[model samples]
Target: MNFASAWNAQGPLARQRREAMLARVGQLRALEQRAAERSAEARAVFEKRGQLLPRERVGLLLDPGTPYLPLCTLAGYLQDAREPDASVPGGGVVAGIGFVRGVRCMVVASDSGIDAGAIQPMGLEKILRVQEIALQNRLPFLHLVESAGANLMRYRVEGFVQGGALFRNLARLSAAGIPVITVQHGSGTAGGAYMPGLSDVVIMVRGRSRAFLAGPPLLKAATGEVATEEELGGAEMHTAMSGLGEYLAEDDRHALGIAREVVGRLGRAPTPALPQGGRVTASLPPPPGEGWGGGAPQREDLLTLMPANLREPVDMREVMVRLVDDGILEFKPLYGAATLCAQGRIGGHAVGFVSNNGPIDVPGANKATHFIQWMCQLGHPIVYLQNTTGYMVGRESEQGGMIKHGSKMIQAVTNATVPQLTIQCGASFGAGNYGMCGRGYAPRFLFSWPSARTAVMGGEQAARTMQIVTEAAHGRKGQRPDPVQAKAQFDKIVQVFESQADAFYTSGLLLDDGVIDPRDTRAVLAFCLDTIAEGEAAQPRPMQFGVARM
Candidate 1:
């Protein structure tokens, strides 16, 4: 590995900019905190019902001192432009990967305290992403479910149509030999009933859970019959009569105890072997920590390294030195100057890092395509640090076959079997986003720095394009464009475009898994990569189909 000596760790200008960027990272963290705390707003109601808040359930379910990676923390910010500040906390769910009884599992709980855990459009998308992660990683799926079903008043047909995939995924997980465990806390009526019905193991809170296909009002409307929630599908009835529930618990705390017991006994795949070296999950037996012992760049330096201003250019090598272990081993550097592909270690996991120095030209994209293929052959994970304006444009580039080369990069990213993680450190615009595994392509885990901006193109570029078209259209109509009016129009368009590109805006819509502090990048990537590695190493026993209810 070549030692990196270009960065002056104590440069005065770097310190000044680092401090400012640190404040922005802090601001985004505060917003996430506020959103997470929204569940506390329903504390009184939860207490009245003698229940714990959704997050509280999650806390008790997870083993103490173990790590948990929260996903989609802010799932609906500014989505309803009518009321931008309205809190849409956590997509009506509090979910992440956590450990239970020495077993690593995907833990998800309904955030019923807020809006009765009703899923909106983005909320539905959040669960779908969670399910996909659970399936891909071969993690056992565990959930504490008590939802009021979808919010019909704010419904979109697309969300409803896509929501069915959640149930389908549950079945797929079970069929794939991945356990689907669920706890019903309360009100699993109507469509919500399917959650418990499809689980491999269902734990029900005795008097609290109400998982009937129809409640009394609906029953009377449909069949002119009277039925209480218990008679239809209460915990006791389900356990003794319906055979839907596997275990009955006295209360919330007791239910979690049983759920932990379930994970401990569900038949583990194998004690998955670790690779050469990498950071190990605390839940797993510890491996040697990935570090050089000393002189590593300060994690906070990342804030200064990646300027918040998208237009500013910084050598990605400088950023790479601060992220990888003892700097990276360069590969084909002179062949493609704009794309920096190198071999490195993060948390001890051997990985290939592809970072953008600028817009990807034909050579850069081709280099990336070749590197991605080689990494897949080695079975190593690839980390894409997105900082590009996207593929180069213009007649010269087109004649040079920019599209053909760019498509190769996209194809490699899409089909590579190795786990891919995307971190949007700066500008992720145009084809750059797709080539870098934007949310649409679904990186195994995707996150953005508070400084990141994502869109089809930069705000200024989009505005200028619109401005030129407006002037041309007015001239064709034989009316000259008004100068002052045209300037105002350009400014308005930029504001709209930039707002949509902001990390907070995109993260809220569940565009990325969540925004992170610049310092947490290395550790977060290491943990996820380790999980994927572990999953890949395990030997799961797959049946022909999902276990069916007797």
Candidate 2:
């Protein structure tokens, strides 16, 4: 690794930026904790019915003292229509890949504590993504089902159409020989009732479980036949008559115990590797200190390296030094100087790096395309540090085949068969966000630094473009443009853009998984890389059709 550290911490600006970043991280974490506690409403409701809260159910379901990778914790962040301040995160489910009786499974518990755990649009996206993860990694799928289904009043046609895919995926998981275990903790009526219907192993909590095609009110309205929840599809009824539930538990605790035993009986996955890793050490080694001698810059140097202003230029090299281990093996540094492609080890995991210091021109795009493909060929994961104004625009770039070259970069990013992890370190605007594996393109994992800002274009640029368009529209209408009114509108638009582009706002909407402390980047990247590696090494069984409950 060639080492030349240029990051030297000095002024008050660094201190100010560091303080701001830390405070934002703290605020977001607090919001998440607050959302979890807000489930107290549901807790009270459940308590009246003699039941545990959603989180409590999740904790009881998983094995103790094991890692739980809670994902997309800020799912319906600011998207709620009621009020911004009243919005709850976590969509409506608490889920992650964790262990149960030494067996790895994807566990999901509906946060019925909030609005009866109604499925929000973002929550739907979260569950679908987790299902894909469990299937691809060959992990047994588990569901702690208890939801009010979708909110009919706020329902979108797209959600209704897409929601069917979840059940289909469940069927696919079972057909692929991956066990689908579901515990009906509470109400699962209407379309939601399919939870127990599609699972290979179903455990229903007596008196608590409620799964039916339609509840009493809906049944009365549709068929003029009034049927109680228990008579239709309760734990006892399903276990004894319908055979929908394989086991009937006396209560929440009994239900969780039965689920654990079920997982234990399945033993290890067909591939035989746990998602969080199986090897256990007696004790964890101390984190590497200053004297450990990796030659990498101190983690705190990140604050000094990052510029507070987006327009101010920064050499990504200075930032890279603080992230890569023992410096980096610079790749194609001279050919596409604007796009730095380097090889490095972070937390001892070998990875190829691609970062942008400016707009991607013809050469930079091609260089990135070549480097991405090379990393895939080498079987090493690629890490993208996104900070670009996007592809250079204008007549000259057009003549230089910028369109064709930029297409090559996008193509490589979309099709490369490797674990691509993206870190939005700074500005992520326009096509640069897409080429750098933004949330839409679906990197294996996408994280942002608290200092990051993402949008189609910078606020000033977007505002100016709109202003010019407004003037042109006025001229076409044969009226003089009102400069004062236009300026007021322009400023408001800019403020909206800047505010929404904040890392916290974007993360709250599930645009990124969650913001990370810049200091934790290397370690977080290592953990994610190791996970995909272990998954790729596993082998799974496949069947022609899904296994039935019988």
Candidate 3:
């Protein structure tokens, strides 16, 4: 069914909402700038050393005029700072998927500007998550290494145990046939030495690069042996003597150039065409004033399409129209009227969309389950537009087996063969999040809009529920409840939920990849889908293990 937008961008309500959304977007940009500024503080030092900053290296390595989707920009926000104002996000690393010599690759650069790039707990998780995406999508992994490794002063036993996964994933990527390339730009001591060791190709900076099982102090203390860094794991030693590195460069810029050349030589094949009439979806031209390439839908009306207030319902199809290249093919629209399952194209890539007009009912759950399976079987990526209060509740819903059906939907989301991406545009409470491939469920990439709010339930409803339980306890004890105390308790509960459910708060905690402007939804989806497609097209020779130092 073709979607016709009745959205009026010039309408009074829409104008108001656009202004509000634009302000929120400004706030998100400000946070990103703060992280950049924090990194910029090291510019003088980098210049003195005749080296490029991490961000600059990334820019040089990427193909000109291509898109780079930065991941987890708000990571370690508020989690590591003494005050919210002092928080520097980015989790001590700069990571994204971008074109390297016309080939899409996952690039991770250590943001050594801050605290010498010591791994924050969230930073570890961020690296692991991106590595997982690279492995699952079969994209090459490129890492720019230069770190002090973990901060033993602030380390926890659990972090130490979980940190093992980082090294294991590097080997896993190599064994799975995806290339793991490393540029030893500065320091990689202790366990960090394994980063370059496991890479299929390692490029090292001559004077500056270092990777060793133990640095001078640690080696002297533990083994009563002392050796200069150069003799132990410097670029010259690693490349010529130890055979750990394949290429040795003179400086950061030279190293990055070598990395780019290596990627160019990888001989990655062009992305394969989608099966089952993929070109048909992009047959229509984009609406007037909407200017994304490949006939993608209009994004100009996006701010107007979504109401500022989440409780006010808007047709999910209206939002979908702006994201896809052409009209959507609604699947069993009549069966689950509120839960929409449609086939569309983003950036000319075939995709399946599951969105919510309201809470998920039994019919909705069953419909989504079937749609997910259908998309997986066809090998199309799934994009979830999450905006649900939760599953329907009440005697009528419970008897209808809401739990069974909702579980089926979650199971499908959890085990779907193809890539699944999620965008939280509005309310995402309780299990609705899980069923829609929320952060916990490990969606390939999950993003949120400024209007998003996530919680177990609405603040008022949670407060009221608690109030009722408290009153019942008092009645059972044959005592009257104090009105003032009960009111104060209810207010406290509401305050906590309301504060924690804000989009900024959740994003600061790394709940989603990053909060995005609603207008950029289509562009983001297209980049992600293209990455997945490229991965599907690639074929690399799997080995029993990573290229060893020998």
> Could you give candidate 1's per-residue lDDT for residues 45-109 as a string of tens digits?
88887888887788788776555677787687777664655655466777787777757789888
Model 2 sits at a Cα RMSD from the real structure of: 4.5
2 versus 3: better lDDT goes to: 3
Q: Write the per-residue lDDT of candidate 2 for residues 303-402, one digit (tens) a residue.
A: 5656668777878877777777677888878897899899888867788999988999999999999999999999888999989989999999999999
By lDDT, highest first, what's the ranking?
Answer: 3, 1, 2
Model 2's alpha-carbon lDDT is 0.80
TM-score of each predicted structure versus truth: 0.92, 0.89, 0.92
Clashing pairs in 3: none
Q: Evaluate model 1: give its TM-score.
A: 0.92
For candidate 2, the per-residue lDDT at 304 reads 61
Off by over 4 Å in 1: 1-3, 269-297
Angstrom error of the Cα, residue 312, model 3: value is 1.9
Candidate 2 backbone clash number: 0
How many clashes in candidate 1?
3
Scored against the true structure, residue 18 in model 1 reaches a CA lDDT of 85
Stretches of candidate 3 above 4 Å error? 270-297
